[model samples]
Target: MEKQTPTLESSSQPQLKLAYLRPGDMIDVEFASATKVRTKLQLVGFDTGRYLLLKQPNPRTEGSYADVLFEGNPVIVRLVLEGEAGECIAFKTKIRAVTNFPFRLLYLDYPEQVENRALRAQKRVRTHIPVDVTADNNQADNTKKLASGVIVDISSAGCRILFKAQNEGGNVTHMNIKVSIGSGSQKDLLMLSGQVMNQKKERGMISVGVRFTDEEAHIIEVFDHLLIDTEFEC
Candidate 1:
C-alpha cells in the first residue's frame, strides 16, 4: 500500500539504527512522498562509508529503474522489523547520482540521517478473549488475588483489558500483572508488567490501557504474529 507523506516533523522520521540493518536485510522503500507504492528492497552490499547496493523490490518499468530512483534525489523508506511493528521507522534518504554497470541493482547514498518514527496507524487489533491478570506475581498476596479481565484490544507492544471498575486503585497504574490470554492450546501465559497508560470507566466497565514492560524482543515477535494471525484472524 502507498503511504501519505507523514505530516510530521523530520525529527519523527525513520532513523536507521545500524544495529537493526545488515547486508542481507530487506526494507520497504517508497519514492518521493508523492506515491504510496513501497518497493521491497534487499541490502545486497554496501561500500562501507560511501554507498549501499540494494536489490530492487519491483520489476523494471518501461523506464530505467535508475531514472525512477532519480539519482541524487531524496527517498523515504519504511522498516517493520519482526514484532517491533509498534515502532516502524520511516526515513528520508537519497540515491547516489552515480550510474555504472552494476547491471541489475541500484546504489543509494549512505543515509546521513533517517528519521525514525512510529507507523502512521500502528497495527493494533481487537481481542475478544478474556485475559487473566495477577496484579502481583507474588502468590503470597492471596488476599490481593488475580484480577479477571477480558482483553478488549491488543497490539504488538501491549493490550487493553476490560476489568471491573473497582480495580482502579492507584497501584494498578504500573502494576506487574501476569496476564494469561488466548484460548485452548493456543493460549499463552505471559508475565507482563503493565503500565496503565489510560483508564476509562463506563457502565461499570473499566477499560485499562496496559503497556507490557521489559519484554524480550523475541517474545514480542511471537506475540505479534499470534495477535495478528490468531486473535484478530487477519
Candidate 2:
C-alpha cells in the first residue's frame, strides 16, 4: 500500500541514485509530508536495470498515499538505509510502477541518494565488553530485572547493546539503567536513567539503542575508557 512507496515533492526533487542497494536490505519508508508518516519495509528484488521491487507495504489509512502513489503517479519516498558500519543514509526515490504479477511489490525506478553525516552526532568507538545492566520499572511496582548484554558500540551520547531478556507482555519500555562498564575488579558501573530509543527483536534477543539521560561527564568518562582500550587492543 502507501507505506512502501516514496512520496514525491511538489517543489523540486533531486536526482538520487544508490548503486549499492541489494535485496534483503532493510529500509524505513517515509511519506514526504509535514507529518512524514513512517513505516518499515524490505527490499525484495530489483527489475535488473529497471527498478527495485519492494515487498508490498502496509500503509497507514490516514495518509495521502492513495492520491500520490497511485498507478502512473510519480511519487517520491524517503528511504532510510543503514550502512554496514551502522551509518544511516537517506535516499529519495520515484515510484515507476506497482506490480502484482510475479510477486507483490512496488517498483522504484531511479532515486536521488543523499546523506547528512551530521546525523551521527558523536564519534563512535566500537567495543566488545559484557555489560551488566539493570533498570527498575515504575510500571512494574518499581521492580527491575538485571540483563546481561554486550556493548557493541559507544559514543559520548549513547551506546548500542545487544541483549536477551524475557519481556512480560512487552513491559520492556522504560527503566533507570545501571550500566556496568567493565568486568571483574576493573568494572565501573554508571547509574543513569534511560529510555529505549529504538529496538529490534530477534528470537529472544533485543538490540537496544539507548540514549543516556545521565550526566555528560559520566558518559564521557566511559567513552574515553572505551576509546583508549579499543585503541590499545587494536
Clashes of each: 11, 11
Best by TM-score: 2
TM-score of each: 0.41, 0.62
Candidate 2 global CA lDDT score: 0.58
Worst 10 residues of 1 by lDDT: 225-234
Top candidate, metric lDDT: 1
What is the alpha-carbon lDDT for the whole of candidate 1? 0.60
Q: For residues 1-234, could you state the per-residue lDDT of candidate 2 as single tens digits?
A: 233445333433333335556566566765443344566668776654567667666555443355444455444444433321344445565667776567657777645445433245455567787777777454546645567888787665666778875664254555456666663444545444566666666567776777788787765565565553322211
Compose the digit string of candidate 1's lDDT tens values, residues 125-185: 7667666776655575552545688877666567778877674445356566666665454
**What local distance difference test score does each model get?**
0.60, 0.58
